[model samples]
Target: MTIRLAILASGRGSNLQAILDAIAAGTLDARVVGVFSDRPDAQALQRVPEALRWSRTPKSFANRAAFDAALADAVAASAPDWVVCVGYMRILGAAFVQRFHGRVLNIHPSLLPKYKGLHTHQRALEAGDAWHGASVHFVVPELDAGAVIAQARIAVEPTDDADALAARVLTVEHPLLLHVLGLATAGRLAESAGHALVDGQRLYTPLPLPLNPT
Candidate 1:
């Protein structure tokens, strides 16, 4: 069965493009029901039809909680089996998370357990890490501390700068999210007690993607 997706993005929507491309190429069995953004001018909204697009500035609402309540209602209206946050900039509140608890997913540009928030590439370079990459995981309340489903790794070269490292990671990240979502739509992936399960078994470690060309 094809799964319906509700995407939340706040930027260029490069990852959203990957999903769209995959579905168009007949590689993914999913349909994008809607695209939601917190920023009125977000480029991501342009990728979907006008009817499937929704945006509301936080300033229009009294507070963050109020904004989230409206956002949750909009997302629930689509009845999405999965909610994928691509470049969504807002931090989701507890009310929104609990509403669709086990169904939210996010892809972060780091090895995770290292850099949970922004500037991951620079942080890794400064720390002299040998490897750096992106991780696709379940989105829980505690930032990116949820169970990782899979990751795409890239070696950090001695000559690499933050920009260079980030560019390299982006190449693999697209495929990484697609891979994880493929399993999800196929009924081979799930979340239980904040843990990731694949093929009905616990995923002790995130499945790693082999290195691709940078």
Candidate 2:
């Protein structure tokens, strides 16, 4: 069965591009039915056909809840089997998370439980952490505090700044999201009893990021 995928992004759709590339390369058996964003000028919108692209300004809504409600409606219209958030800046409300539950996934720039929110690279540098990476996880209501499925680790260089670190992490993020999504499309990855499951087995720890050459 072909997996119907929907994407929500707020900036340049690097991850979105990765998924598209994977689908085109016949590495992922899925179709991106819809691409939605809060910003009309988000570069991610250009990755898909105009008909599949959707944009709405959050300021037009009275509150975050209202915006998310409308966004949920837009996503539901596509009847996506899974919703992936890549560079999506907004935090989803409880109602939206509950509506999709385990089906919604997100990729974060830092190893989760370390930096849950933005400025991940700067935070890691400030903390003087030795390693930094990205995480692919199930999206829950509490920020990035969801069950992680996989992570890609990269060593922090002494000369690395936020942008430099981000660029390195992004290299792994592309392959990581593609790898996890492939598992999801094949029904090999799922959430069970608040824990992530792979091939019907519980995942106590996130799987390591697959090695991809720069």
Candidate 3:
């Protein structure tokens, strides 16, 4: 069966595009059934075909629950097997988290368990960390605290700032998202023994120094 996917984004659709490209090239067995955003002007929404359903609801719908309900409704209409958050900036409520459970995935710009929230690049530079990168993980109620699936790290160069590092990290993020999604769509990724197991093998918990470009 082809994997049906719903992608949520709040900014440019670079990550969304990566998934689309993967599917187009037959590297991933997934199809984007829907695209959604909180901001109607989000560029990602434009990437979806006119035939596919896309929505942008009020950010302050009755409340967070109402917003989640609206978002869930849009997602369910697509009948997707997975909901992937590329650059979505909302803090999903617990109810929404339980509804999706293991079927939801998210990509964070920084190696998780390190910088859970925003300003990650700045935080990394401020802390003087040698390496910084991205993570693909299951979406839980906690902010970027879910069980990690995979991570791609890049060295933080001396001249790196938020914008420079973010751009570099995004390069790694695009492919990492596709790789993790491919595993998920193939039913080869799962949580086991506090780590993500793929094809009966444990994926590395985090990317280490002397980072690889992939």
Off by over 4 Å in 1: none
lDDT of 1 by residue, 112-209 (tens): 77799889999999899999999999988788888999999988988899999988999999999999999989999989988999998999989989
**RMSD value for candidate 2:** 1.3
Judging by TM-score against the true structure, name the best candidate.
1
Model 3 gets an lDDT of 0.83
Model 2 segments beyond 4 Å from truth? 210-214
Task: Quickly count the clashes in candidate 1.
Answer: 0
* lDDT assessment of candidate 1: 0.93
Q: Write the residue-wise lDDT of candidate 3 on 67-143 in tens digits.
A: 88888887888888888998999887788777776788899999888999899999999999998899988888789
Error in Å for residue 54 of model 1: 0.7
What TM-score, over all chains together, does every model reach?
0.97, 0.97, 0.91
lDDT of 2 by residue, 31-85 (tens): 9999999999999999999999999999999999999999999999999999999
Worst 10 residues of 2 by lDDT: 205-214
CA deviation > 4 Å runs, candidate 3: 192-195, 200-210
User: Each model's C-alpha lDDT?
Assistant: 0.93, 0.93, 0.83
Kindly provide the TM-score of model 2 when superposed on the true structure, using C-alpha atoms.
Answer: 0.97
